[model samples]
Target chain A: MAETVKLLFSATRETVYMVAVSVLIASIFGIPLGVLLYSTDRGRILENSPLNKALGTIVNIFRSIPFVILLIMLIPFTRWLVGKSIGTTAAIVPLSVAAIPFMGRLTETALREVDRGVIEAAQAMGASPFQVITKVLIPEALPSIAAGITITAINLVGYSAMAGVIGGGGLGDLAVRYGYQRFMLDIMLYTVAILVVMVQLIQVLGDLVVKYLSKHR
Target chain B: MIRIRNLTKVYTSASGTVKALDGINLDIEKGDIFGIIGLSGAGKSTLLRCINLLEKPTSGSIEIDGVEMTGLSPKELKEMRKKIGMIFQHFNLLSSRTVWGNVAFPLEIAGFDRKTINEKVENLLNLVGLSDKARSFPSQLSGGQKQRVGIARALACDPKVLLCDEATSALDPETTLSILKLLKDINEKLGITMVVVTHEMNVIKQICNKVAVIEKSRVVEQGTTFEIFSRPKTQTARNFLKSMFICEIPEELKAKIKALNGNLAEGRVVKIGFFGEITAKPILSEVVKKFGVNANILYGNIDNIQGTPFGTLVVQFEGKNGTADRALSYLQDIGLDVEVVEIG
Candidate 1:
């Protein structure tokens, strides 16, 4: 049991690293992608239907591929990116790729929820495209965006468990090897229980941040 | 001066093309409180939007101070819009921003330094009489207060032309009057050229120096309020002018007149509209004094709009003889809009 606890501690660290890195990287690419999706809509700020469609297709393609299949398919690309395909960093490649499109679509939905009248008012005030995005779109959608980010982070936590298929060191690997293959039900239960706690903590923390950001509150 | 010539806007959609404005031409002089009045979907809003290039014109040109806006590039157009401020029926104040923040947004976009932005926002807040609510979010304010914030936000950059789209339609009657008064004050003090779009007759009558009536994407009539009130040439203008004021006869008085007249068709209830210098001319007493034709003044509405006195009276002539004709002709000769109504 002491050895099992030791292995669980290291697996937990690996799990946190993979999810945290994936979400951070996803945010870097996904935020701009989401803004592009919303702004390029016909009659919107950028107002280019062709650009919107092309980006939308790319997002859809990434989003539709099953996470398990995506992890297997990205192995060679992951090897080239991280110089290895069977470690925590290698797991980040597939995890972030899966996360990017998911987070981007959420961001698009959040931006779309902003009042169109507010946007027009900004334009009437002579706000340029960049000013409208930074000052109006993002700020107005902040609470919704926060909630979306929380959801995306929680989803990344679940997706990271799939990284264990490629010998990635995380809670999923411990659960599959020690608990499933070695028939230790206690280990599997412990990992699943910890994952649930992580999800709950993220959700509560997110709700608080969103509530605080809300001006109407 | 702002001049628009032959402007047209067509919305081509999957359904069909909607000609929002068809050849709308207007000239708003500096400091003129111009009104574009029409029913919903009559294209008054479209006309106002076209002025600032919020909706790009499919044809025609808009010239502000002799600079052609239609051909201006996007950057130039944006710079031009800095001189044109717009408010809306919904107020459109950002929910995420405080009243001060919302007001500061325009100035910030113009790249005003922090101190200048602070001073300008303070002055605008004072101008709109919302200094006490600077820290309040838009959702926490009343409708009138929210509108005041919207006005302040629009004025933050000290725009030369202010466009109001049904700015008072969302308020109560008392609130509407106060906001209208505020707008009039802003116009007079700042000398800002205001272009207002509204369907409320009182809104037009109370504030507008000049009005253009739009019908089916075309301006059917455009003139001073006094001219439109006194002589409406088009059927659409006449329809709008007829019921504009508080002209409803009290039910008790209508019944009393009907009882006294004894005959429904023969009762002489004339709805007389008088405007300009003629409202104070005492035309009714003149008819009574000259023809001795007992003119009973029953009900009327007298109002002073933009320093012009406009009146509508429901008068009962004692006798249904040709005296009514003479009186009407005399009234017409004196520049009064007179109509004979059959009262039963």
Candidate 2:
């Protein structure tokens, strides 16, 4: 029982690190890509139809691929980039790649929900496209975008656990190594409890942050 | 001054072709409050959008202040758009911006210095009677207040022409009156030509000196407000006037008037419309004394159109058969429009 508890603690830390790092990378690339998708449509102030469609198609294609298959397929590339594809650090490459498309789609949806009239008002005022996007669109969409980020963060937590199946050092790996292989039901139970706790903590924090950021609140 | 020649816009949707504006030709003289009245789908809004090239016309030319807008490049179009202000029915102020920020937007886009922008924004907010709402967001404002901000922002560049696309349609009656008065004041004070598009005759009556009635993507009637109201030429103009003024005359009221008056052969009921200085003259008394016809007043309405009094009187004439005809001739001779109505 004591050994089970120790394994659960280490696995919980690994899962937290992987989820946090991957979400950070996803946000960096995904938000800008999403903004680009929004501004580059036909009739938009900075319209470039081909570019917008191409980026949108690429994001969609990546999002449609199963995350488990993506992790396996990215193993060779992950090894080349990180010099290893087994640990939590190497696992981050696939995790963040999977998250980018997911986060981008969420960000795009959030941004699209912003009122077009607001953008027009900005343009009618003689604001450049950049100013409209930054000062008007982004600010108006911030609350929805923040909620989207929370959704992405929670999704990444689930993806990170799946990453453990490929020998990635997280709670799922700990469950397989010390619980499944050895038939230690107590270890599996403890690992499951810790993961539940982690997920619940993230969800509560996300809900609170989203509520705080919302105008109605 | 704004001039549009053969301005056309065609939208080819999946279903087929829709001609939003078909060869619209208009010349708005300087300092005239021109009103374009039309029903929904009448292309009035489309005409206003074409002025600023918001909805780029498929063909034709738009010249504002003698500069052909259609010929300008994109950069030039943007620059020219700064000098042609437009407001919308929805009061499309940026929700993310405060009242002050919304007013300052155009100035910032014009690349004014921070201090000058601040001073101008303050003055504009004060002008709109929203001086205390500088820091308040659009969500915090009422419909009237939001539209006032729209007005202030549109005036930010101090354009020579202001295009209003049903600018007061969203406000209550009292607020609409105040906004109309404000626009009239602005027109007089700044001498800015305003092109107001609305379906409401009241709006046209309140501020427009010149008006054009559009129907089915075409200008069916165009002239001074007095000319259109006093003598509507087209069927479209007559229909609009009937709906605007006589909508309150219920079917029961018409039936009662018919029952009380009997058949048309007994007497002649004429509708007389008077405008300007002619309204003050006791024309009814003069007609009775001059033509020896007994004139019984039935229904009457007098309204001020752009500070000029326009009056309409429905009266029944009783006496000799030829006396009614002579009375009508005398009324017309005295410069009052007299249209004889057939009683059923």
Best-matching candidate per TM-score:
1
Where is model 2 more than 4 Å wrong at Cα?
A1-5, B247-250, B263-266, B320-322
- Residue B309 displacement in candidate 1 (angstroms): 2.0
lDDT of 1 by residue, A1-217 (tens): 8988898899999999998898898989988899999999987899999999999999999999999999999999998988899888899999999988888999999999988999999999889999999999999988988898898899988888888898777888888888899999999999998889888998999999999999473
Chain B only, TM-score of each candidate: 0.91, 0.94
Measured with C-alpha atoms, the lDDT of residue A149 in candidate 1 is 85
- Fnat per predicted structure, each in turn: 0.78, 0.38
lDDT of 1 at B263: 53
Global CA lDDT of candidate 1, please?
Answer: 0.88
TM-score of chain B of 1: 0.91
Could you say which candidate leads in DockQ? Answer: 1
Candidate with best lDDT = 1
Instruction: Provide the lowest-lDDT 10-residue window in model 1 chain B.
Output: B260-269
Interface RMSD (Å) of candidate 2: 2.6
Interface RMSD of each: 1.1, 2.6
Error of 2 at B164 (Å): 1.4
Q: How far is candidate 1 from the true structure (C-alpha RMSD, Å)?
A: 2.3
